[model samples]
Target: MNLHSPSSTVADADLQERGGAPATWLPAVAEGLDIRRIFVAFRRRFRLFAAVALAVLLAVILVTLQATPKYTATANVMLDTRKERVSNVEEVLSGLPADSSAVDTEVEILKSRQLAERVVKGLKLEEDPEFNAAVRKPSGVKMLLGGIASLVGAKAPNLPQANSVEAQKLHEEVVDAVLDGLSVKRAGLTYVINVNYESDSPTKAAIIANKFAELYLLEQMEAKFDATQQATTWLNSRLGELRGQVQTDEAAVQQYKIANNLLSASGTNLTEQEISNYNLTLSQARAQVAEDQARLSTARSQLSRGSSGDDVGEALSSPVVQKLREQRAAVSAQVADLQGRYGERHPEMLKAKRQLSDIDTQIQDEIQRIISNLQAKAQVSSQRAAAVSGSLGGARGTLAANSRAMVRLNELQRNADASRTLYESYLNRYKETSTQGGLEQSDARVVSKAKIPTSQSSPKVALNLALGLVLAVGAGIGAVLLAEMLDAGLATAEDVERRLDTSYLGAIPLLASVAEGRTEAPIDYVMAKPLSSFSEAFRNLRTSVLYSRLGEPVKVVAITSALPGEGKTTTSICLARSAALQGAKVLVVDCDLRRRTVNRMLEAEPEIGLLEVLNGEATLEQTITLDAPSGAYILPLSKSNFTPKDVFGSVAMDKLLADLRQRYDLVILDTAPVLPVADTRVLAPKADVVVFLARWRKTPQHAIEAAFRLLSGTGAHVGGVALTQMDMKQQTKYGYGDPGYYYAEYKKYYVS
Candidate 1:
């Protein structure tokens, strides 16, 4: 259902060929439009545009050459942006290193009025006449011109400060001079800038520029170093207050420990010593109890034996004779049994009794000794505890003192470490600065400094001369175009054929003027030399009239025109004579009552003319007079009370024209302007032929149209328009200058 492509029909291509793509070739929106056409058009008419450009160029050169030469000397000084080290420490702020913008700031400061005043004082540029001349106002010239122009209304500049006017003037002069001399150019993508000063003297210019850079750098360094010094002073004052605070804290801690009598001092909330000391005291008591049990056991063994650690088992059996015998029997029986195994009172049996006795005695003594030793140890431990408690009290006091001293010392040490770290940091930064500053890392370097230019860059002579030639030629072409576009008269034979649809009779050459003084009548020239242009024009008119309708000729034809001074009278008189020369009856009538130039140019006898006949004061037959035309007839105007319009429009005037038409073979009427009066209006209707006369370069198009409008209103069958007063010089200027220009190569049978 969709068919889309870059394909176009043949019609589209045709349209594009005829007129560029309507969508894409829009004249208004197109960029970089080809103005080549304009240039070419100017080239074809080059003499004009070039001439204009040349004149302007010459005028500028002349003005430039005549102008007084003012020499300018320029001096360059680099606005160095190298930074200076105020301190070693590099600041970290917002995660960025601090970069000083002071150099740029100084550049601006140097441009300020304060610095300008200083320079003025330093250089005394005001005293320099060259400096004053460089910035002089145009008031002197203005005052002179203003005086002359005052007649047409111009006023002088008003100075407001009347009292201190001279002082203000001097101050203004200095300010103006400084501004003129001072110039600055910033480096591309860099901190360096160029300061330039212009003066008549090269040394002065160089001095000013260099001095600004030096002074500004000094000012910047002082400001930054002073700021650093203030910071150091603040830090030192803070350090002193902290030291005093530490000492006071130490003394308070010591006194608290001495008064409380505490064995140990509280640590800084993280030391573990009390638990270790309690466990050590318990171990010492246990060791004393174990030693006492060992000593008591050895003492009991010494006390147990009757014979030096021996015991008697036979004593019970020997007990005093009988008892001793019974006891002895029991003892002997036991001994016998024992001797059976051990052989008669063996030392093992005695040792067993001795061992049992020793064990019993030792147990009793150990219990006593245990009691004594426990009591003694209890007493000794009591005394030792008292001594330990006493010592611990002293230890608490000493520990508190030491702890207090240690805490104060640590605080001071910590502060000292932080300060030392900061000082080291600054030192490191100073080392870095020493390297960087030495390198002078700025982007722009001076290539070549400005010096005094020997010559001004104005006024090119060859260029101006070339322009003048172009301008002159161009002006000539433009004048021709203007003349053509503005031309209103019918200038060519084609105009007659196109407008009238009639044969082009011919054209007439321009008359030099009545003052050029012709001795003979125009007919004499035509008759004497029929081969001449004047005669040829008349002959062509005669033939065209004769052969127009394939008839005998134009008999009793009246000639009239749209206006006067369009050669209607000349045409009329010439036509009549040319016909009369052919032996035809010819009558010339002066119908123009306003101007009787025909009668005047011909020097015809002054008598009652057309108005007299119309007023019934004279008959047309009776008023006919002659001068230049002896064989021909002329009807001149009478000094009638009637106007040209009245007499021409009257029925009587109609009868008179009819009478001439009937009476003569060729009758010609010279009429007034078809626009100004109804004379031509009345005559236009009556005459068989009506010719409109237009003067070259004189008759305006609108005037011609108005004349034609009058004729058309009257329904006059306007024959054609005739061009009069043609000049060959004027014709050549407009490229399509003459009708013959179309056929210059072709040999034309005729030309008007």
Candidate 2:
């Protein structure tokens, strides 16, 4: 007898399962997602992707078709800051420098309420049917939302009324709407500005755009004109005041001059001329006095020396005086010679003396005339000096008086000069302003007028459709991934083995009868058609179970699941039949007292089963029935009024399993789900190997883990896990794992 202990098999199977390579779908133990698995997931959930994509595409199409078309027209305005008035005064006083922020300012002005209002008024958009429709006719989407809200007992919003207050409100609303549709942008760094307006009516759009350009230019011209006019008016007023100030200043200067007696003659003041004349005449009189004094001293010296006036400068300078002096000298020499030769009364000496006496008399006459002339000249010089000195004293007094008044006179003159200069400057500015007032020019011009659009600008069909397609595809992929994440079902054998940490025995394909639309009672395909792929899968599972134990062949194998409807009973029946077909004696026992399905699958009519045997009302031999097709013994649980706990807890249940193990080569027990009841837990310790069954793509991974935890807590020997009722075609199509592909690749080998 091959007696296998549950501990030894469990230890060996754990080592074998753990030693196997990690599942390809989950290559790592961390949070890394395998791309291959992701592809499989998406492929498996392709229906969800298709449905989502189709729905999104349909919605996009509907919205695009129902959207209202709009036309846009643009007018170009050249904001030439260089175009300005050619007035130097205007440039200096009122012109602004070229500012970089001017473009942004112009854009804001274009978007301003005033400009919008002007456009509205010019086009009479308030009265246009198209413009009014935007306010009156609500969009379809909004109407639908409103209807939905009404159904939920919400009040719809009220529309504006056509009254004075509401009319004003509506007028403002239209202006705002116009503003909203307007777009103003600078064309690169150039001076050209594009003003675009969109509306339902092409003509209205064009008219509004053109009007905005025209209004902007007109506004600029008006602003410049107003500035020039203001400058002119201020200059005119200032000019009048300056003219009066100039007159007053000149008058004050003249009055100050007259009050101070600061009179002038021929560019020279009166006091200054009199002082010049007095100085000149005084200088000449002093010189004459000095000349007369010198001449009188010289004449008196000549008379005292008895040399007469012959040696004197004045007498010598006279021709008559010089001739008389010569005659006297000759007579003196003759008298001296006669006196020396003869006595005092000699006749020649007497005659010579007489001649000398006569000559001396003539010389005396000449000297007397010279002395008299010198006295007359000296007297005239003294009188002239006295008269000029008195006149100089009067001129010096007048000059002193004029000096005292010059300070105030100078201040008045400076005031007059400043006033005259300022008056002339203002007069020139006023004249320039008056001339430039008529020459003010605008800084912007309409370079291009807006024309009526021939085509709609909104609801770009091709672009919208392409974008919708891209979004739909993205949404579809997103939905698929989300569904894959939310669903934690074990889809493949790898999921059961790797995630649940269990041995993967094999996968049982879904029965062909079910696939072929034959809904009859499920049969053990191993017994019905032993050579089929389904039967072959069970045979493989049987081989794995036998080899699970290292030192001994496995006996008393228990098949169970996390929850009900995992096909545990079907798997157990098929495995038993496969073991029996190998010429091994196998007994299939139905341990689910609550829901007995094995007996139904085998068409067993035995009234006594494991429950009855455990209760001591029947023996194992009496309760067990032999199936004719498979020749396998089946111990069904008949209808009993006993709880699973009561039956599975009995000592007779252990004895019955021990006796069945001795009697059969292999025993298969189909127990209740580990999650729902304690029947599997109670029977698990009695079996040599425990096989956990997970329905393909149906059992949740957490559910299987929980079941394994429960069984492990109870010290049950979990041999391995089996994936049941798998669709091989779908598994291969989605590339779920290696098992499906292996089965597909070797399908022909199993056909014979």
Candidate 3:
């Protein structure tokens, strides 16, 4: 079938547009994953991957074997909210709180340089070579570097020497070393803090860990004790000042009292006492005067009314009046008996009446005397009351004068009381704090003491090996990808068409497979294995060349490559043989006069070759030889160093091609590589179809593109590209996108 017929050409164009070259590349790139491509790339560069992976794994192994094993020991210290209480008094320094923040603070304290220094000094770590750099031996690498530096006369950097410096510097270095090995962290939002230390020796790790815990507790205790002591001292000093103030204020009160004559008696001043006494006395006197005046007025009222003093209460109760009344009663009784016995005007009756009258007079006299006594007592009481009132008035006047002086005294007394209260308060606090100094305790305690570790914590063999394996895999993958990116060669049919933007004719299998242990040239092998894949590929190439253009047939075909050893001569001869076997007359002309590889390939040592024919030394008929196996004509060159300028592009060469085109159905020129020689570039434009050849998986695409660019510049119709030396056995591994992908499965169709 003519591949270049209108229907076939349109079909090819549609196939390519739908899923040919563009499909091969787009699916690999746009989809972002092509497993077959990856497999092929890996297969091609597996050696590089292996080398990188092995090197990385070996380095890891060496480091793991040489590393010094370290042991870790941990001790737990918890922030204790519960502490033993000796007294009800509050502490000068409070205990640590049981919160995450508090635990974090304690963790920081454990990591502090202060505690680290304490541990270093307590454990005498400055003498240990593990911590003291000056005492430690130099490592092998460092010694080698030092030796190199000395040989080169390079001065070492000046660093502080621990032995030469002060003891403080050495201690500081040891502290820093201890801190570096120590890991203090709060255990997951808990009040318990973990104190971990790493060291070469298990015992050393345990000892350091325990030391940190012990020192941390001790630090807490000391801080509390110091705070208590400081509080006690301050209180003691303040108490002394307050005591002096109290004494001074009390003295001032006393002095003010003395100056003001405001001395107190029975919790009151003298004037106040006097005022109270006078108030009582005046009240009593006023009562007495009122009583006396009432008595005196009653007596005078009775006298003015012409009534006897018998109505007076004092007169009525008089003992003499009572006696007179009894005697009068007796007289009256005698008078009544006599009157009854005798008539009127009896002497005894008159005597009895007279006796009663005398008794009554006596009573009157007694009542009047009582009235006089009452009046005298009333006047005496009034005079005594007036005297008491005068004395009370004088005392009240003195009290008013003293009340004005008491104000200043009261202020002084208040000042004294405040000072005394303050002094007592300080004294009490001083006593409490002084007792607290000896009773201080730490806020934290060790919950778990560090024990000597039995197993090493570092240089874990299994873990290191796992990590090494992962790193090796990563490095291998990276190296493979890098090699793929750096490669510029074309391997498959898809690569030729997609990268070069040209038609892909076919892939020619390696000659060895077609020969199949038969000793024959490539052209003879093609003739011997006519049904083989090698011969089939050449027939496909011939069809593509003959039908590349619909209007005119491709009679003159040029076979060339970017570089030598690309199977260009074999392709030319095989293409000619394939056409000749198809019942068409074909001739192959070796245009490379410099190397003359076709003569060697064809075993033709003609005395008259293309050089002789073009230089007019011989005729074309004399120079031409026949490949008897395939019935193809060959015009090979003899071994020579003579190369003429523009020989292939000369008029004689054009005429020879024209004559061959007229006589033969097809004429093929096996030309030199385009990049190395100018013969192929000048000769390629004369052919109707130029088949650019590349070695499968061997020739770089940049070389092919460069050669194609030169050929196109010479106005050559480069029909397509074909890959020679294709490995059929390995081609299946490249997957379905490649031309020889099914070469293995289709081997049953071949007779070879």
Candidate 4:
């Protein structure tokens, strides 16, 4: 709540850490915004807000009326991607939103200086008077000063002649003005941009709008062509390399097959046949070898048993030869294999048996052929191996030679494969690049053409007016608040209470007749509306004075204030008159001996009075005189030959007051302002109540405090203050306009 730190116990951070709620102010603002309260408050200040608003509106309307008419022409523009889509409309913008980064790019282009310059040059507005005036203020000031000196004091010194520069400068100014006048913006999410500009010439408006469109469209086209040209150059370079790579890869594939003797076999057709034939031959040879080993094993067994080992049955007994022998045996494995799955008498089983017989016969024939070939070739190989073994002395030498040849062939194959893979990949990329290079982008096309605009987009008249209104209202309210803040005067009823430190007596309205500009009878309120101001204010004061202590009576009342011009004298006279009207014999005293103004107020006869008696020259009744009204008695200051302080301080003065008190029901004394004179301080010892007056908006606050300090021990009870000259505007600012409110209620009795 406190923006500043207090010197005593409180701290700024502690107050802040109270953790104000974000919405806490809402309830308070809402409560203060009560319809009646807000209305009343506004009504009180209605003159102020209305005055401000009227001034602002009138100023705006006058200025706008005098303003040169500016007609705006606008053109719509839609952006085009400027290139066909690559294969699919969705591909280039795949999963992208409609508001692409490119859209912003175009917006920036429209606002770019390059485009602005183009518009400026096209419009040739730099030479225009209005724009030249705005831009040439510096030069104008120099010219004006020089011209002034030329006229009044001395002949102008010769200045440099710049006719050419001035003409060129004027041309440049025209272009800059055009640029300033133009405004381009994308209206919203749409592809359309609104190109608007303002000009005094209607034909020029349309012309500028059209020119901007042409320039922007041309710029976009040029940009597209430039980008495409660069891309084509790069793509062509890549494409050439790709073409050579693809050819190289094709050649490598062909060459690898020829060198490896795999041309036919590696090809799809021959490869399939070779795979089938190799498997068949390997199966047949394996069967024959197994049969031969089985037969040889049988023969060995026969030989060991002293039977004819050369017998065919011996081949079946040789396990190694038996497998081979069984392939060509009378007993067939094919028949057994089928017999386990099917009945032997079945047609399929019978056919398998016949096929097995044929296979056995073929295997036997093949084994015989191998045996015969081995008999001869094996003899030759053995002879050669024996010969080589004798020279090298190891079989490993022959094995090493064969391993080296095979390793060399495998290395060739690996190299060929690597080259082929590399070449093929390059070729594929080249083809793809070429194909893509030909593809076009579609989908994003300009729906509208770019155009020069004729209207500027800023300094909206309505908006400026609204803003001015707001600013004026703020300034007016601030002025009122500043007035309140700097107020060094009596502020309110509460301030009067605090200064006086006494029970509230009541209040009287400041009248034109009472102060400022005129002097009239103090009983004016009583003569006109006695019940409102005079009768009401006095009756309330009397009741408060009587009931303050809840005592049986109050006989003597004293009136004083912190300073002069607080209306203390006036109040004393009025109080006595009111009491006298109620049939009470009241004696009013001019007890302020040092500054006696009241004695002159009643037009009392200059004769022996209170000072005379206090000096022991005259007795109490001899000095006291009856007033214009018989029920009231006036005791004024006697023209003492000396200062009357000694007289009033004497015991005889006290006896005179006692005697007057018994004669009159009520005695009112008008004393000196407490702070200015010691007489009131001295006389306070005998008074019952001290009535202090604080003139509103006039009496400084510190003066009242000083008054209380001066009269602290005075016998009189400190009575409340009578605030004078209340401000109507203040009542409005503080929301005191309503009848039920305090200001209104008090006004009814005090000011009405």
Ten consecutive residues with minimal summed lDDT in candidate 1? 91-100
lDDT of 4 at 208: 74
**Candidate 3 residue-wise lDDT, 61-179, digit = tens:** 99999999999999999887888988988888888766677777778888999888888889989889999985778899988986886665434343334324655777787888888
The collision pairs in model 3 are: none
Clashing pairs in 2: none
- Report the C-alpha lDDT of model 4 over 317-374, residue by residue, as the tens digit: 4455556455545446657766898877988788877777676665555445444543
What C-alpha lDDT values do all the predictions have? 0.54, 0.76, 0.80, 0.59
Estimate, for each residue in 550-667, the C-alpha lDDT of model 1 and write its tens digit.
5334554445555566777777777677767767778888877777867666765466777778889877668887534436778887554446246667789778777777788777
Model 2 over residues 1-752: C-alpha lDDT tens digits?
A: 11224564464366346543223344432568677676766677789999999899889989999988989999998877675536566432343335657776887887889877877887788876565553466788988986886565434245323345667887887877778778999888777889998888899889889999999877777787887788778878988898898899889988877876667523338778888888888898899889888888877987788875667788778878678777777878787887888967999988988888888788778778878888999899999999888888987776776575776777878888998999888888777777875576667778999999999998888988999899899999888757655556666656655556567787777875223453443464455567767778888898888888778768899899999998988888778777777888988888887778876666555666676777778887787788767778888877654562567767887788778878999999888999988778888878888888888777876677667767776667787888887878877744455667555677766532
lDDT of 2 at 240: 88
Question: How close is every model to the real structure, measured as TM-score?
Answer: 0.49, 0.61, 0.59, 0.52
Which wins on lDDT, candidate 1 or candidate 3? 3
